[model samples]
Target chain A: MKRFLVVGSRDLTEYVNGKYVPLVVEELRAKGHDVTLFLIENGVIAARDGSKAGKVLNGLSDKGARVYAEDVSCRARGVQTLASGISFSNLDFLADSIAEGFDNIVWY
Target chain B: MGKTEPPGSKKKKTQKVAIILSTGSYQREAPTTVLRLAEKLLERDIEVNVFAFEEAVTLTNRDQIEHNEPPSLRKVLGDRHVYVGKFVDQLLRVGLHGAKMDWVTCVLCAQERGVENHQIGGSIVGTLGDLWKFVRGADHVIAIPTYR
Candidate 1:
């Protein structure tokens, strides 16, 4: 399995319901790769608790996929109540993932 | 360092790409990567589907655009039939879809952008079901978000 840093977006309504954020994360883990999902902008909401995605988000953690959220994005978007594995980080984390050899495949 | 295949050794690889943007005209690095990736897949004859949602719907709007480098907007959208209504038909025309997905949040986005009644053609904008369908079979999905 290839190293993937899947990207999520900010729109959680209409086209972007919460279920998919974890669906992608779960698939990556099922494939047996070291995976981590980065929530940027709207993606940050996936990290929140008590949502349908929180179950999947925590499942990703169980399967060893680290969930990361952008701190700046969180603050900018005014997101609170993050999920278990979801935590804040920097946008440079994305760059670092790339430098560490994660081919990015984002979902917004 | 691993057993990675050389440049164009891929023929039947599966890919799922979701692109979210504020507007189709925001020619940033994300779109650049996405457009280039779509082009590469088409060139390699690998299966590629770019789920365009939010402002990404603008990706198919080939009118009055300006990001034409190796990623020619006219060519990229034209090649994948990103022009909207014909996206799937065009993919089939090029013999490139085992499964192609459309993730357009056209209504929500349209309203946000005051386009709730925008009659732009070349695309179909509808429901979350479509987004889930795309996510279901996606090998990999990416989002380029639009602030709207």
Candidate 2:
């Protein structure tokens, strides 16, 4: 399976074209490709417990796509608790992941 | 000052990363995010290529200066502020020693913004060809477009 890394830097409420990132992630998962959703900056808002974005991310996680919220971003925004299936990550993970190689790396 | 490999010896290929920054600084967090990622990537010994276009061409403007904040806003604005160009300059300088970083400012964009000749040292005025070249040669590519 082709590997994909999608980085989301904006909050869900700031969609310019109807939440393109989630749709792209969903499509990739539907196609059976491995996908990792990395949330950074304000994008960590999606990992907050009980938030609307968290629900959407939960759905994607149920489909086997991995989700990670940047630790620094989460702390900066005071996102103390994260929704299920979302793990705290750091830039180190991001750098290592890039070095590991991916078929596609998209930023939103 | 560099070591050369033997005529027939195989040399390890260095990893290369290309970051396309299309947004300007201060207004959004995209520029800061891209810079942080570039630094982290370089620390891993990866060669970084930054292709700046649109308003991003102003990021390396050498005219950036930190001025004293007005008295009314001193509490919030602080006495001094850090400009993004300083970080870009620092990265370029440090990259000279280890994993090299090449920062290219789009010529057309810089000209339109009147920053073509105001860019910091080592900022290359390049065309779309450089952007495509970086993308084609990179082992990984990260594109941060305008967030607005």
- 10 residues in a row with least lDDT, candidate 1 chain B: B1-10
Q: Can you list the residue pairs that collide in candidate 2?
A: none
lDDT of 1 by residue, B1-148 (tens): 0122122222334444444444454443354444434444444434444555556555444343233345456564553322332342354345434333333545676566554444344345666666667667655454555543
Which is the leading candidate under DockQ? 2
Per-residue lDDT of A1-108 in model 2, one digit per residue for the tens?
Answer: 788889988886777653778889999999999888989999999899999889889888998888889988998899988888787888877877787646678888
Per-residue lDDT for A34-59 in model 1, tens only?
A: 56677766666656677766667777
Candidate 1: clashing residue pairs, number: 18
lDDT of each: 0.53, 0.85
The alpha-carbon RMSD values of the candidates against the true structure, listed in the order shown, are 12.2, 7.1
Report chain A TM-scores, every model.
0.79, 0.95
Q: What RMSD value applies to candidate 1?
A: 12.2
